[model samples]
Target: MAESLGSNEVTFRLSRCRQSVPRSRAALHAVLGGWGVDQDVLESAELMLSELVTNALRVRVPNDRQVGVRIARLLEDGLLRLEVSDAGSGRPEVRAPGDDETGGRGLLLVEALAHRWGVEKRAGGIGKTVWAELKAPDIVAEPVGREVAAVMVRPGQQVRAWGKWRAVRTVRTESYAAGGLAIVLGLGEGPALRVHAAEPLTVRDDSVPSARERGEGTPG
Candidate 1:
């Protein structure tokens, strides 16, 4: 059984070794398995993650510094975003494979499989993070909090706002108003929310291989 952290998401600071690749991958599979991600999306995520981490580890940087891997559920867009950060500033490029080349196509494979991909400088840090996004299969499972499960915000049902689950002041569902469904709640203080995968509701909150776990495996 994996250790549970109150929050969802994991960030593992990998050592300068190949093992980090698999470690990160396994962590993804474990977390996604618990969240009930689609098998196909999970597989693709594993592959893309491996490539990014592999590239990060392959960079000829100091061994003392560590690489970082983050797996996040982009619920707003229904995307699974995998990011690998390394100290090296070199931007990875997809190269065309030579007829006799045995390797050199990691990014190419990433581009082919990922729904979209990009690289960005680490905010408030050195180096950059190479990220890829994969579309998650529509699985309408409910996104739940520690005690309350997510459901359609019906009238009278309390909701999160400013600082507490304030009484759901009101709900609007006019086709001409805000279009579809919209919730009226104050900003801030509310606990983070989730969206159900298979239903029309709002709520809260992947895999590669087998490897040993090391580094700060903070839950993603």
Candidate 2:
């Protein structure tokens, strides 16, 4: 079961089992999606949450002990915090796994992806909590017509490509005599896609204003 700690916080107690990891991630996705968190940030948060929960499950705890998962959205700071607690002793540490080694890299991934992360002794005095924070931007999907300027496209934004929404990783501009300017977006997956400045592309606008909107000239 999950508990609503406050308007912006929810906590879940999961059994010390492997399935709990995915369950915790689903709960996180539901809560954050309801809050209209940006998709990119939500995805990152989910991955970090999974890693933390997995680490908690690995702790040498009694069978009756359950893993504690807490997710809080700090709107004032535009951050999403994920915490995993368990009634176990040792703290998690990041490690560099060798080429032949297949495991022990979970914390390393968390360290690289999270904006910041740390471990603290649990308030109960018997366990520890590993937590991570990610910069989360509130975003709403808006239908953008084909007339959107090519210069307006930016990385970290999502575009409707190949019949589905894909995150834009890179944006490039090419000028041609016939097309004037074309926007080539390097998506998070698959191949790059090219769209004309006036082509229809659905985009989700982020809370942060784009450079052009902020009076800074379009990025080259």
Which candidate number has the best TM-score?
2
Question: For residues 38-104, could you state the per-residue lDDT of candidate 1 as single tens digits?
Answer: 7777888899988888898888889998888777776668777888899888788999999899888
lDDT of each: 0.66, 0.79
Weakest lDDT window of 10 consecutive positions for candidate 1: 206-215
Task: Report the lDDT of model 2 for residue 41.
Answer: 77
Between which residue pairs do clashes occur in model 2? 146-198, 146-199, 146-200
Clashing residue pairs in all predictions, respectively, total 22, 3
Poorly placed runs, candidate 2 (over 4 Å): 139-220
lDDT score for candidate 2 against the true structure: 0.79
- Root-mean-square deviation (CA) per prediction: 15.1, 12.2
Q: Which candidate should be chosen as best, given lDDT against the real structure?
A: 2
TM-scores for candidates 1 onward, in order? 0.62, 0.63
